[model samples]
Target chain A: MPEITFRQAIHDALVEEMRRDSSVFLIGEDIGTYGGAFGVTAGILDEFGRDRVWETPISEETIVGSAVGAAIVGMKPIAEIMFMDFLTLVLDPLANQAAKVRYMFGGKATVPMVVRMPSGSGTGAAAHHSQSLETILMHIPGLKVVAPSTPYDAKGLLLSAIRDPNPVCFVEHKLLYKTKGEVPNGEYTIPLGVADIKREGTDLTIVTSEIMVHKSLSAAEDVSKEGISVEILDPRTLLPLDVDTITNSVMKTGRLLVVHEAVKTAGWAGEIMASVSESPAWDYLDAPMRRLTGKDVPIPYNRFLERAAVPQEEDIVREIQAIVSNQY
Target chain B: MGSNKINAAYDNEETTDARKKAAELGLTNEDLVSMYEVMVEIRHFEEMATTLYGLGKVHGTMHLSIGQEAVAAGAGFTLQDKDYLINHHRGHGHFIASGADVNKMMAEFLGKETGFCHGRGGSMHIADVTANNLGAQGIVAAQIAMAPGVGIAIKMRKTDQVALVIFGDGAANRGVFLESLNMSSIWDLPVVYLCENNHYGMSAEVGRVSGKVPFKDRAEALGIPGYFIDGNDVLAVYEFMKNAFSHARSGSGPVFVETETYRILGHSKSDRNLYRTKDEINQWKEKDPIIRFRDLLLEADIITVKQVDEIEKKMAKVIEDAVEFAENSPEPNIEDVMEWVYA
Candidate 1:
């Protein structure tokens, strides 16, 4: 095992998959010669040649639609939408055609394609550029939504998504690309719909994903000194959610605090709360499930307001402490 | 009589040359008869469907391929079992000619459990995977763009099969259609794009929608060979399709065919015949493919009027039985609505 940044891990997954399966190819803007916008796929063109590493025009619809077409014809394509917000332009193909094709054709057609995008705010890419839209994609029925918070998970999960017989919306947190973690070389996959328990505690179950997983874990360590133990659960995949892990954590803690960078209104946390409340964890609840999410506002350019719009480690620390203390 | 004489004069030279070519290609009379039967089957199926819809038995939108049956019939006759097909909204003829279960197709339109899609997908979306009828889409030109991908897969799997995509004249204007054509041409994918130009795209005439460049010329501009044919003539359509399919099967890239025909009905069930004049309708009706083909078979003494009537009666019975079966079949379970929403 060796330490690698999240971006490197993703690049490794692409390289390995392309080498292993000739059908697998990469297509996106600047992904070939200029590398990806995040530099994750840097130097891939030199390795795989121009045909496999396609440099597409800045048409999100064309990129996604071509991927859908390629995937249908037995090519496994990894299409990169430069930014997650730009996914809006290609939603019809991804949500309507690629996602629904397998079921619509009665399991006769499978769109084994990966649509990777750099998601969430923190890069000062205000308003239109910075958005945490994982919740919106999670709401779509036929897509498998994955948001990996670590380098190890990124490599493992991207491999799993590539091999998945369904369409996957793989969201990578923009800020976490440079974050380093131990990743084993060679083939490995982290199964979708599984949650990782980062820190175990009895006081409160903190459910989160993407970069918020890292924030929650850091906050948990800080709150542990204050006599409040927090259990941090990272739901690696959103659609086929790991409800059992969160429910079991809630059963032990008797308290749940859902935290995400997405806006609180109709966010992925709401689905988590609904799933938990319907399970056996409902009887084990000591308090109402609390959601600490970004304020429902467009991320502004002003640093203070931008920070206020999303949850930070301090916010998670304060919210979890208050929930554990039962403070009003 | 002068027009007939000229047509006969051209036929003498063309048919003699075509027969010589057909013999060189080892095409038997059985193959010709089978091809003719496919065209008749497709025409009969669409006519029955249109009649049922007019009688208010079938619901929702229906885009009949009555006049353009020869295009689908000819192309489908050339497909191998492993070959794939993607069709547009007016796709019943394509599916029927490809040997999709007639009962399941009728059941699909009736929204029944016995439908090809288990009643979930209706007429425009009917799909039979086992038969390699990938699916039909309502979106114009969308399916044509995906044909190259199917061709790519067949090539990758080392299967000597090609993908046949059929769309209407309206689809040629779409960017996806051109994009897919370019990709297929560049990659030399085993595919054929059959553009059935029935002269209407929901009340807008083809002449109004498209510049007067002609459909086949568009393909020629893309550096691919294009074939223009009278789609009403089944044998002519078949001959052109056979040439195209063989070219693709031999790894010579894709071909484009423009089938000139007309739609007898409106674009959909809600459409009124307000766009065209009564004289125009009567003119095209006189050229009705089913009637024309029946007359041709009668003139050639290939079969008696009684035999033709027997075929019609048999197809009508099949349609009626399918309708009854669909009417009796149960609706999809409400609980299952959320099941297929995910993988």
Candidate 2:
């Protein structure tokens, strides 16, 4: 195992996949000489040459639509939307075209394409560049949505997404790009519908993903000082949700909490809770299920306001403390 | 002025002159006959489809390309099975032109299991990938954005195959159309952007929407060669498409072509024929591609009037058999609704 930044892990996964499969190519804005907006594709042009690394104009719709077209004809295209907020401009290609092509064509066509969107607010990019829109993608039936929390999961999950027979939306949080974690140096892949229990506990269970996984872990450490044990679970892929893992954890702890960086209303938090309540875990609950998520407001440029918009370590800790104390 | 130039090039009704022009384009007697047969096939398919719609046998609205048979036949006859075609919503003619199986197309329209999309796509989304006929899209400009990617795929595979994308005049105003042309031009991708300018896009006339600018200017601005051809003349469209496909296959980048044609029917089943006058529709009917090409072949003695009648009879039988196949085919199993959502 080698420690690598989440960004390096993603770059490594792309390099490995492109080397292994000739059909795999990267197309997006500034992906060639400019090396992508976040530099995830930095220096990849030198190795793969101009054909595989295409620098496109600022046309999000055509970029994703062309990826769908290329993917249909036996090419694996990984398109970048530059920012998750811009995914609005590409909904027709991503949701209507790429997501539905396989089923619409009676399985005669497959869009093996991955749309990588850099998401979340933390670096003061304001409302336009900062958004946790993975929930929007999850609503589409044919699309697979993945949000990884660590470098290892980022590399492995991305590999699986690239090879998945259908369209996959890979959401990378801007703040998590530089976070370091142990990642295997060789080829590896984590299955899409699996959940990872970041830490084991006995009193309570917390389900979360992306940047919130780190916040939940820190919150668990803080709650432990108050004689409360908390389990943290990250459902890496949101669409094919791992209900069994989530329910099993809830059954053992007899308490559950869902945390995410997305907005509160109509978010994955409520969906996860609904799934758990419908499962066998409903009878095992000793406490009501709770959610800690971003407030319903646009992310502001002010650092304090941005931090207040989403869940922080302290917010997660406070939520755990309140739930344990029967504060509802 | 531009329309007059293009019309004059194909206004020659002389039998010998038409044969000479066809020969100049390397079209033999068999090719001409096959071309005429395909045009007749499209005309019959559309007319029958309209009848089926009237009888409430076909579900969902369908956009008919009744008067645009020559555009479909000329381009469809020019393409190889390995070449790709991206079609728009009003694409039954385009699909038939690209060698799609009539049985499957009719089955899909009738919502049967044996259809190309297992009855999932219905009239607007028929696709025959095995024949390289990428599915027709319901979205107005969706195919335009996706066509350049097919060109990219061909370029990547180092295949000489070119992607011939067909859209309506209305699609030219979309941003993705411009974006695709720019991308294909800069990358030197093998693509032919064909705009079937059938006067009106839905109720909005092309004259009102596109103004005085020719459709070719859309591509010419991007450094791609643009051509305006008389779409009602099958020979003219066939000859121009031949040069365009070759130029694209030569890796000279994409070419844009606008076929000046008309739609004798309304835009869709929902249209009431309220936008244009009946006189306008009748005027377009006089220049019918199928009748014009048949007259040319008959006068040239390239084919007998008896032969032309036989093609109409044979195509009528083909359409009848297709309807029977669809009527007897099973509906998709409801239990398998979850199937094919992914690979």
Candidate 3:
């Protein structure tokens, strides 16, 4: 096993897949000479040359449309938008085109492609550059949305996403790029729609993903000192969500707290909350399910305002404290 | 980030040599007659689909490539089995011209289970993977963007196969079309861009949509070899497209072509001929590619009156059989609606 950064793990996955299959290729803006806006593809161009590591024009729609076309014709294309916010330009491609091709074409076509982007708020990137838009993508019926929290998960999920027969929106947290964790050197794939239980607990279950996974785990660790056992679960893939894991966790703990970095209004946490409520876990709830997510406002550039916009470790701890205490 | 209008003008382009190029390209009497036969099949199919739409047999009106059959017949002749094709919603003409099964297409259009897409996708979403006809797209310019990607696959796989996408003039105005041209140019991908400028983008004339810059000239501005041709002349389209395909196949990069054609019918079944005069329709009808090719073949002794009559008669029967196949076919089961959604 090798300890590597989240970015390195993703880079390794791409390199391994491209080497393993010739049909797999990379397309994006500034992904070649500039090595991507975040330098995730720093040396990919040198390794694969311009053929495989294509630096496309500043055309998000075309980039995605081209990937959809390539994917339907047996080529596995991974098209990277610089930031998840820019994915707004790709809605037609994602929602209207890629998501429906397999079904609308009556099983005649399969768009096996990855629309990858850096997501979430941190580093004061302001409103337009920073956004956790997994909820928006998750609403799309045909796409598989993945948000990995650790280097190990990043590598494993990226590999699985590339191999998936359907389109995947691989959302990497911008802040997690440099975060390091243990990753196996050889091949490994963590299947999509499976949740990872980071820290098991008996008193409460905290379901989250991406950067929020770290926040939830830290909150769980802090609350453990007070003899409160908190469970931190990450549903690595969003669309084909692992409801079984979330429900089982809620049934055991009898309390559910869903957290995410997206806006609280229609965020993915609500989907998790709703799913659990509809399942057998609904009767086992000792307390009302609560969500600690980003506020319903555009992310501000001010460090303090940005911090207040999304849930932090302190915010998670405070919310969980309120849930366990059954007091204000 | 900027725009520069090119020096190319559609008005100044050379007129097509329908007869001379037919000889130069070794288009035999059989080849020319075959092109005519495909066009006849398309025309008959469109007329029948229109009747079906009128009878409420086909839901969600279909777009027809009625008078634009030359573009289909010619370009279809240029595509090899391994090459890829992306078509506009009005692509039934190209589908027939490209040698796709008429029975499957009719069944799909009629919403029958035996359709090309198992009836999930109706008239607007037909795709035949075995023929490498990727799929027909309903969106205007969005479909053109796929060619470069398919071209990328061809280039990366070290194959001589080429990819071609046919769109209307209305679609060429979109940013995706220009972006595809620019991307294809920079990468020198093996792709061909074809624009059938049928003079209207769903009633808004092409002039209003694209400010009169010939579609091919816009492609030329992107560093691709651009040509403006008579789309109604199947010989011209065939000659020009053959060059474009071989050019791309030889790794010379993409070629953008604009074929000046007309759609004699309304854009879709819902359209009435309110936007244009009947006289204008009559004039384009006079220049109808089918009649022109038929007359050319007849005069040149390439095809006899009997041969032309035989093709027309055969096309009517083919379409009639297709209609029968669709009429009796079963609809998809409700329980399997979600089947084949995700692999």
On lDDT, the leading prediction is 2
1 versus 2: better TM-score goes to: 2
> Would you list the clashing residue pairs of candidate 3?
none
Higher-DockQ candidate of 2 and 3? 2
Q: Model 2 compared with the native: what TM-score?
A: 0.97
Deviation from native of the Cα of residue A160 in model 2, angstroms: 0.8
Q: For candidate 1, write residues A166-207 as lDDT tens digits.
A: 889999999999899999866889998899988888899999
How do all models score by TM-score? 0.87, 0.97, 0.96
* Cα misplacement distance, residue A122 of candidate 3 (Å): 0.7
**Tens digit of per-residue lDDT, candidate 2, span A219-271:** 89988988999999999999889999999999999999999989999999999
Range of the 10 consecutive residues with the lowest summed lDDT in candidate 1 chain A: A54-63
Q: Which candidate order results from sorting by TM-score in descending order?
A: 2, 3, 1
| Structure candidate 1, residue pairs in collision | none
Interface Cα RMSD per model, in Å?
A: 2.7, 0.8, 1.1
True contacts kept of each: 0.27, 0.76, 0.70
lDDT of 1 by residue, B269-320 (tens): 7788898998987888887666665565566556578877777676667667
DockQ of 3: 0.76
- What's the distance in Å from true for residue B236, model 1? 3.9
Question: Please, what is the whole-model Cα lDDT of each candidate in the order they appear?
Answer: 0.80, 0.89, 0.88
